[model samples]
Target: MIRTVVLDIGETLTRDDRYWASWGDWLGIPRHTLSALVGAVVVHGRDNADAIRLLRPDIDISAEYAAREAAGLGERLDETDLYEDVRPALAALRAAGVRVVIAGNQSARMGELLRALALPADLVVTSGEWGVAKPARAFFEHVLAVSECAAEATLYVGDHPVNDIHPARAAGLRTAHLRRGPWGHWWADDPAVRVAADWSINSLAELPDIVKAQE
Candidate 1:
């Protein structure tokens, strides 16, 4: 049985609109411009943060982030930022006795923001807090360590193939590629993603049935 469902944050559980928009505002650029740059960056297999660097090659993202926070323009998340299916799917999984964990590449404050929302989860953590991010073997090792279960029993889900499916699978965890976000859709049909992922799902709502099938 799939005992644990560990999920990524951005574009997996939540819509990234507010996030990119916030960055756009902070950078004093049109939201659409930043959005497009982010798309281009991701499409080229570059980091999403490269979008900002594309605009200002010398910018210190960490410093700018601190400046934003100092100016009261930091990250913020709420119910509206979440996809409609998040609560229902997570609740269903938890009700079915599946452990729900939210772990993703986000800031330390993001962990706080997610906790403030009180989502139905056993743990809500971020790379910023752990000092580790996805796509790294070490990150998956941490995931396995915290799962309280074997990798075979833990299912790691996320929208990004490189950061989620590939690395998690490498770590021996069952991987579910969520085809909900840009990265998901972009790589969904690729043979690499299909091969790396044990399952490719468009929504979290589909997860419960997949878990039940193992019964």
Candidate 2:
């Protein structure tokens, strides 16, 4: 039985358009230029941060992130940033007596912003708060701890295949690949994603039914 549902943030919950656009402005790069580079990096299986590194080869990512924050141009989260189906899907899961957890590779500040929005979930956390990121064993260990359920009984949903699908499946949690964002669309048809995720969906609205069916 799927007793818990854990979701990733970017693209799965919120679109990264504002985040990237802000970064582009901070870096003094045109929006289209940075976006194309980001897509190129994703296609090559590189980290999204690498897109910045490609444009500014000597930039220190963490330092630049801090600089952005110090300048008051850091991570911005508001209601409109989230996908339309997120709230409804999370609510349905909770109504069905399922534990909902939101955990993703986001900064601690972003975590605070997310919590401020008071999303419909039992727990909300991020890799930055845990001091570890996804595709790492420690990250999944944190997830399992927060889930309070056997890995097999938890369903992890995210857009990225490598970070969400492969690792979550390997860690023994059931996974759903959400085809809603750049990474999602890029890798959705990959055989690896198909093999890794227990379910592949295009919308969060489908999640409650998926959970119910498993039960």
Candidate 3:
């Protein structure tokens, strides 16, 4: 009976179209160049961090993210930045007596940012807070422990097939692939990857129905 729904933040609940472009500007690279590099990384099945390291070997990722945050990169998020389906889906799930959690591979300020946006999540967890990132078994273990929910009774929804679906499925949690962001649209046709998810949804509007069906 899925008692908890764990959701990814970027490109899942929120649309961050300007995020990479802002990063490119900060790194002194052309936006298009950075975009192509990111696309290449996805195509080659490499981590996004690898692409940044390949482009700027001297760049310190942690420091860069710190600087970005200091400069207010992820600080303030407007309501329009969120997907139209996000609020409705969250409301429906909450009304159905399901615990909604927002968990993601983001900086420590992620929870604050979501709060600023007034996102409807019962709890928010981030990699920075947990000291581990996604695709890591320890992270999921932490989530399960914190939520106090059995793995089989949890559902994880995210856009990344590798980071979200595969790892969550391996952890015995049902996985939902949101087919809108880069990971979803780019890897949608890949049989090996897409097969990992229990559900593929283009919008969060479909999520409430899917969750009810799971029950």
Candidate 4:
């Protein structure tokens, strides 16, 4: 039976548009400018940090940018009830005797996000906290160690197939893929990793059933 559920934040439990929209709202910068800059950096594979510095040369770019990002996250997420479906799903899992957890690539802002969304996770694990990235064995290993959960009794859920599902599966944990976001179409075609999940659900609303089925 699955006793632990580890969730990834971005795309799985949160939306990317919220971040961009919040950034525009908090920074007083034009949304289109931010979009163009993001496209240049991400789509064109340009140096993102350098591009941000050059684009807004007049501002103390790093501090100002981080503050805006944080403020935007706080505004859209922390202050607002962002993860409405998430809380109930987690509560249901908790009620069913499943341990709910957050395992992702968050920095120091994780606490703020959790408090803002009022997420009902029993544990919080992030790359910022572990000083490593997901899909790396150490990340999952560290989480398992801290939680004291056996690999077989734990399940890891995320939007990315490799980062969230595949590695966890390899590590002997159950896996779920939330398949409706930017990374959705990227790896869906890879035959080796195509159907790796123990279960797949499109929304957080379906997660409780998946967890209960295992239990």
lDDT (Cα, tens digit) per residue for candidate 4, span 1-215: 77888888776766666666655556666777876675565434343344445456676754765776665545345434344577778888888888888878666566456655556778766687788877789888876875557988887878777677888888788877776555544444556545688776767778778766765
TM-scores of all models?
0.98, 0.99, 0.92, 0.73
Tens digits of per-residue lDDT, candidate 3, 79-142, equal 8779899999999998988899998887677667777776677888788788999999998988
Query: Which residue ranges in model 2 land beyond 4 Å of their true spot?
Result: none
Clashes of each: 0, 0, 0, 1
Q: What would you estimate as the lDDT of candidate 1?
A: 0.91
lDDT of each: 0.91, 0.94, 0.83, 0.69
What local lDDT does model 2 show for residue 152?
93
Q: Provide the RMSD of all predictions against the true structure, rounded to 1 decimal.
A: 0.8, 0.7, 1.8, 4.4
Tell me which residue pairs clash in candidate 1.
Answer: none
Q: Pick the candidate with the highest TM-score.
A: 2
Clashing pairs in 2: none
Q: Please give the distance, in angstroms, between residue 25's alpha carbon in candidate 4 and its true position after superposition.
A: 7.7
Which is the better candidate, 2 or 3, if ranked by lDDT?
2
Q: What digit string (tens of lDDT, one per residue) describes model 1 on residues 103-159?
A: 999989999999999999999999999998888888888888888899999999999
Q: lDDT tens digits, residues 30-115, model 2?
A: 99999999999999999999999999999998898988889888888999999999999999999999999999999999899999
